[model samples]
Target: LWWCPTGLLTLLPLHAAGYPDPADTPAGRTVLDRVVSSYTPTLRALARARKADAPATADRRLLAVSLPEPPPGGVALSPLPGARAEAAFFERAMPGSHTLRVGDAATHATVTADLRTHAYAHFACHGSQDVNDPSTGALYLWDKPLTVLDVAELDLAHAELAYLSACHTAVGGATLPDEAIHLAAALQLAGYRHVIATLWTVGDRTAVDVATSVYTSLVDGAGLDLADTAHVLHRTVRALRDADPRDPTRWAPYIHSGA
Candidate 1:
């Protein structure tokens, strides 16, 4: 399912809408158990992503950016101690195909520069959504925040997946509810074929678990394939839901956007 929600509907998790009664059969329980869901800012954006050329297998590179500790002299942001572990997991999982930019190394400048060369990016840090002005929403880095406007301005040809294991990366602006202006949408506009993001605040430990499960299913002898992202995410989320059916907030917040 490709959702193109407008106005306040953009803020809702349409993909996760369904009854979760234990008595119901698996297929009838929730949307998570049914079809794979993806969101698009518009139909045109979906078309553009579909038209994008797939990067060569040999050219596939992963950029893992983690900020476990906040840099000094900045607006205080909570430390994501699990981010370092997440990046390290990626390094071990992808081996030579991954680059680690942890702590002081994960600056806005370096991340943007690395995004150009990498086919995939995994940001394990703090994300802030400016509800009043979504374009100002950003992923907090070492030197500064990588805002929605910054990502929207990029034109990456080889971009594939951007796994934003940060909080509220998909929340749209309250002032312009119909605009679909958020970090996830901005990344799609920037030429990433797919993006994995969160609609609300997520626990650091849960982020690690979700990333680990998703990547474990994605990586194989043939390597990661962007085409299977939605399906893999669907399965991972289903497993999470099954583990804790009472807390929809834990599993339902994670969403896939783009092709």
Candidate 2:
């Protein structure tokens, strides 16, 4: 079982703890480099937007944090949402003094604290699915993991944006009969204005790069509308792979925005 690196660390390795030498491996380096480039500007734009939106005297700020490693190849990574990108993505995406909360599942208390306090949240992990059964849809964590039902229970009010970098969190269109099993739709109805999710089983590696970059763009208003966000991400990932339409999986499957 091999797990990939993504999330904030997808942009910065040094700032990210628990993870190995992400830049040391060829695949790791390529992902890190792409995420760093895509999110650098997005981060700046987000800070500017946040600053203007903040009320005078409000101490609103940005905070990016992550665990150590990705899921071990064949094993589940704790069944909670966790991002694996570079930490720089956060440092740059949200400028100004930021809080850093680093810990494994052993420190579930740490992750819980940050989620309750942070304004932005990013979760990149293995998202389980069975379009026929969303109750089964869950985010895999490296250590401490809260189930999807648990996520539904937690009041994610302070958090403005949640990037669900997982696979098939939203893929229950014609397949299911009763109700669609779309994570984004469910989250939005739950009061989340911006919810970034996948429409199908995206390549873990490709999802790592595409989601990190797109989320960055959305943060900066490059594609505020969910529809635009989905299009830009689909096109960007395909462009990276050279637009090989012959290979559907290479340039297809991954879709988002409006269900």
What is the C-alpha lDDT profile of model 1 across 43-85, one tens digit per residue?
Answer: 9989999899988887588899998997667688888889988
Q: Indicate the worst ten consecutive residues by lDDT in candidate 2.
A: 10-19
In TM-score terms, candidate 1 sits at 0.95
Pairs with backbone N, CA or C atoms under 3 Å apart (clashes), candidate 1:
none
Clash number for each model: 0, 30
Q: What is the C-alpha lDDT of each candidate?
A: 0.88, 0.45
Which parts of model 2 have CA positions greater than 4 angstroms off? Answer: 1-84, 92-113, 157-159, 173-178, 219-242
Off by over 4 Å in 1: 22-27, 176-178, 221-223
For model 2, residues 1-259, the per-residue Cα lDDT tens digits are 0112233222122211122234345433333223311121123333332333321223234344454355445454543322434344555665554554433441445655665665555555556665445555655554544344555555554344456666666544333242333455444433343455654566656655665667556554321233344346645654654444245454344433322
RMSD of each: 1.6, 13.2
